[model samples]
Target: MVDSLAKMVGSLQKDVDKSSRYAFQSDYALFIDQLFYASSASHITYTSLLATKLGIDLSLNRLVCLLYIKDREGMPLADSRLLYALIRTIRTRMTNKNQDIVGLLGTSRIVYCPYAETDFFSREKLENQLQALAATLANTYPVIVSVSVGLYAQHVLEYGQSLRSIPAVVQQNTSNKSGSIIFAEDHLVDYLLQIIPKSVLDHFLGYAVHYLQENPVVYETLQALVCNDMDIYSTATQLQVHRNTVIFRINQIKEVLSLNPLHQDSDRFKVILIYTYARTHLNKEI
Candidate 1:
């Protein structure tokens, strides 16, 4: 049954690709719908395999279990042969560790050809299938398995690479840390692009905006400090302000931003990053 199902899925995928080539823009929606249906059907066969292996016949309706393998260096693993290798590796790891395969039914990763240069499906639909698969796996496996779904979409790959470029501090602090892949919304990318010119904008924009709203004077002081070398006296002199005034502004900035310029290297680095991002990206008139 599993072999038959796999062959069926393989044939459906080829048909989807072929149909995608002649599909009009108006028919794109239907094409995507068909792709989702095919993927869902394929998932069902895998679920059955899991059920048979576990010796339990559970009426699982949907596919919702998802696992993500961290792909560093942007190694493109979209081909079915490579994907099968990865899946085999995962299975072997679980088996060697004495983990139950039946527990992995709904929690398995589905490897799909990348969306680039392919006409039969949309990446969004594939992701939706993954979410569905994850849900199903949760019920069947009775244990949460992080299913890593790989899409052979260039945009997905590009976005993943860009998100990876975001500093580790940001990733560690964000909500999407557990999953190896960083799924970003369109607005999130826009936000990053908007702030890209300014180095470290991600680090300090929130604090800077908040503090600047409360104390506008700190804006000028921050500008001077960032624009000049790391010489406090030189920055003070350049601003044509008393050194103490510069010190006072720096202290106020530290207090407001919850940053300590004296002892905390991380905090200092954050401030510098924010200032750089602001100066470079925002181009705000200081």
Candidate 2:
């Protein structure tokens, strides 16, 4: 009887130890996911192996979107339940449910895609998805959420750096425009872009930029036009407006800036470059 009781006790201890180990591994895996959000390594061998051990695949190209949630007055959601629900909603809505990986980074939720060129999560589709998701979140959660999506990259490692660029990009790109889906700066070349003189920027496109700031409709049209290679139809389609509306806005922008993005000359360069910088810069005005 004594021997049997000792054996039973040992078995219970072993089970407890096993459970603890499993829990530790789970926590470690989560930590690694967050770490790689800011990762700069060529490829994280340890993280890859860790992911494999946990049945995750980090071999494919990667993209990350960081969602920062706040109250209507711009305060963090201090309630734990809200944070969990926010993460779950974003993950369920943005990810493939069974495929894409989602993790928590501090108070933010990180949606990571190891599958590049996916139908729902691909570079082309993500912005639309995020914009829709942001609307959904605003309606459902009653909180103001800002989204930073970063996929423009060369190597998988640059993705981590891309994630790190969210804050500065948010500050510069949208002027803290709540509920905006911002694209993260993908390269270090932005450091130089940031140094472009505010005076020079104003000299060329300042009136145009400020005019766009006050007129969201024309501004977005200009935005879509420039991004879509100055295609009126594409800008119209993207904005869900009439082609003539896009054309009218394009003309408005031309009138405001006295330069045309449609032109293939130095005027074109000034409008495109300066408007981009102005639209994305922290201050709307010099």
Candidate 3:
């Protein structure tokens, strides 16, 4: 049964990569449904296979993987050396008896740590440790990490499905005034909206809400610049916009929103996040 399921999963993985073909494959949907059902049936086998595919050793019995990817808008692009160093550091921590870190995975400087438990106390401690490790890494590495925790257990498949829906819930929380989703401890969708100035939120939502209506060329230019940390002149040249015009639009955005584009990195990051959420889930865009 395991071998047959593995073969089916491998085939499904291949199909997933062939977007054009898979899009029209009725069998693909059936395959996905079956895969999830299998995952729920034997979560350990599924998670073990997932870890193997990602080239990580799953030695821990009760493990949870916290995947950390760089936030491009707020951090620099990752480098190979930095990623290696991070993996080494995490491995050392995981092996430490006090830390109880089990294994580490790395790809393009994104780190994944599989731990021994999902108990809230342990998870919170792990998060703090990871944050500290990230800070230490940032001093030398060029990237800043954003973590998404995925707890593993007998019901890991169910948990994984819930985690996948987080980005969607976050989007809904941002757009629907009446909608509420708990993003973090004591932080709900309505809470974030209430804390941030209404005018500022409106300014961000203005650009994000009507992003599709705006010229794709301009939108792409802005997104690339924000994501890649490209210089204004270079971005303008790529977009075929005059440098002065780029400055003008940026200035207008800052002035109207009462934010200084040059110094408001955190604010800019929030706006970019909203833009990303809106773009990825266009149908749910509020």
Candidate 4:
């Protein structure tokens, strides 16, 4: 069964590349999932083979993302095993043609593209380049892509380590009401939330969850405030409400959660943590 499944996956991997240039095949996801769940013995071997064939690191993060990519489709992630496979092909084609930086694909969809200081002068320029890449991808696949930029490092592995905050960031970036492109440099505080353990993060945010069930408006306001860097004006502009109304909503969040993110830096981290936790668990955009 394992050998048969492996052969099928290998053949499908080839077909994935070919189909990506035209229109993505959606049927392969079920086949891959079947291969994935056929046997515990086969899972590691098949995952490794897929990783090796696609030139991706078999990191735990990648494994988890591969599992979740099925659900993230059209939700800023688009989906499928072929998603990562297609991303790998894109990276290789770009490198072979010398059109872009060689990116690192940590999972089925997230491609960490490293750029130099000379790549673009401003964030807008870098974003334009990334959007063009997204356009290329959307041409073949029917999904919008989100990008997190301004990541830097001296080595490739170190760059991967820096992406610890990315899972949370991507969720937020894709959830953003304004745009799909997220500049990590701009949202440094939310990145710090990654330092907290998941259990602790969840526990800390549990208050907000409870409060949100009764008052989802407060939760929505909190997301707007944090995603907008706690700027009242911007939050109001985005939420399409009066600045005073935004402040009142924020005050309500502070009162209920007993966390004044606007008044203290530490408290701000807690708020970001709660927001990240909620975003991941609640599947609701903040």
Candidate 5:
């Protein structure tokens, strides 16, 4: 009788331990989510203090890998496998043992926040890693997920812009690429296009297409310029041409378009709007 009672007590204790082990920290997750939305100085400061108290290291670099589980038809999906993989992924990559805050937002949103060393991340590496992960997930799991590894934020405060911009990125870039996650950072032109009216894009796309067909190199140069953030040196390197040649092309584009994108901010925005629309939407093959 004594042995049986001891065994029963051990079994109950094991069950209790297992339950607590898997329990979701709703309050912690919610607090982290709200901190991303925090903007004002006072509020941000308060959140930072709260974060410190909770053992969240405010010093490390933070980046979120978004697993927007969706079907091939561009529909969001609900699958337990997504959560399963997400948890494992975070656990594997989590740098801080005390700071793993995974946000389980709406049905479709399962976020993993990983804090790493300050000198650890770069944009190109993050994108490549996400792409590899997406492929691996598709092959490893039965559920269909459109994985577009998102750009990581250097600070938690920067999460607001990234999170807000993702929906538009997914909507605009998902039509042609199924089983691939489209990101706002990757299709930044698409993100820019969404804010502008369809009528404006329509008006400018024609001019962009005209130039794309006339001198494909010109469009190519412009695309390189935009991609390189209008640096003549970088654009020249990308095109493998002289910086003078890049400058000449910029002048040529300016003379023809009647706008100078290199110098003026407004002109840069307009030309960017035109460049992205033509490259992404019109299918002109520039």
Candidate 6:
């Protein structure tokens, strides 16, 4: 009986050790995942094998995720839950070290594909290639390709900010109107584009929504004016109304909001914020 009890105890200890090992591996995998999106990289020999088997031109020095998710129900694809899981599965196939970075903005992710001693295309050439690739991706997917230059270490940070602002800048400025890829350096004019995040813009506009609701023409008139760079004549031409009509509504908006969105510097910013807010949210209410 003594020998049997000792054997039983040893068996239990072995099982507990095995469980602890499994737990450690699981926890470590979770930490690696946090690193992936913290815009940051690690080890697996499997990356090369998988790339060869898959016939993807995987590179170590530079790789971009170029996320392409097709539309669902006619809205921009924003199913991050599904996409993040897919990314994790893909990461499992990678052998990148800590220097490899990953970044996420909205439904998009930027991943640094790294390798040893091989410099990829120059920055300008890479940007052009990514832009052309973005055009092709847009045919089947609502794509927003954002890329950055400089070392992988610095590039990921810029890539994160660019991904946030580029799609909106391109959509507002370009005629194609669907999603497109843009290089961060090429679109430095995002500051002039009123590239406000939707949530922040919504919160700021909430204070004056009652005024906007009471005077709907003010919203329309404000939108046209800002899109035309605060020009009254251009706004009038675009709205197909007389220049005086545009001027009259601008005055009315000034009275209601207690600021002239057209003339005052602060009000110009406010008007752009409200215009962006309405485009993304309040238009549905109409």
Highest TM-score model number: 5
Give the local distance difference test score of model 4: 0.54
TM per prediction: 0.31, 0.52, 0.36, 0.45, 0.54, 0.47
Residue-pair clash count for candidate 3: 1
Q: Estimate, for each residue in 98-117, the C-alpha lDDT of model 4 and write its tens digit.
A: 31323224243444443343
**Candidate 6 backbone collisions, by pair:** 39-102, 40-101, 40-102, 41-97, 42-96, 42-97, 60-114, 60-115, 61-115, 63-113
- What do the candidate models score in CA lDDT, each in turn? 0.44, 0.61, 0.47, 0.54, 0.65, 0.50
| lDDT for residue 220 in candidate 3, whole number 0-100 | 64
Clashing residue pairs in all predictions, respectively, total 26, 0, 1, 1, 0, 10
For 45-133, candidate 2 gives per-residue lDDT tens digits of: 43444455566555555566777777887776676678777767767674555445566566545354435544334555767777777
lDDT of 3 by residue, 95-185 (tens): 4443243322324423243445534336556567656665665555555555444334334354344344334333433322111112233
lDDT agreement of model 3 with the native: 0.47
lDDT, candidate 1, 149-244, per-residue tens: 322223212322332333322332333223223233312433354545444554538557656645657877876775674468988888899999
TM-score of 4: 0.45
Better of 3 and 4 by TM-score: 4
Q: Tens-digit lDDT track for model 6 on 61-104? A: 45433444434333445667655554564355444444343333
Off by over 4 Å in 5: 1-25, 39-46, 71-75, 79-85, 93-101, 149-156, 175-183, 189-257, 260-269, 275-286
Where does candidate 2 clash, by residue pair? none
lDDT of prediction 6: 0.50
lDDT of 6 at 53: 42
Q: What 10-residue stretch in candidate 1 is worst by lDDT?
A: 99-108
Question: Tens digits of per-residue lDDT for model 5 on 48-129?
Answer: 6557668777656666556665555556667666765655664665446576556555566667555655566666665565
Residue 282 displacement (Å), model 6: 4.1
Candidate 1 ranges with C-alpha deviation above 4 Å: 1-204, 277-286
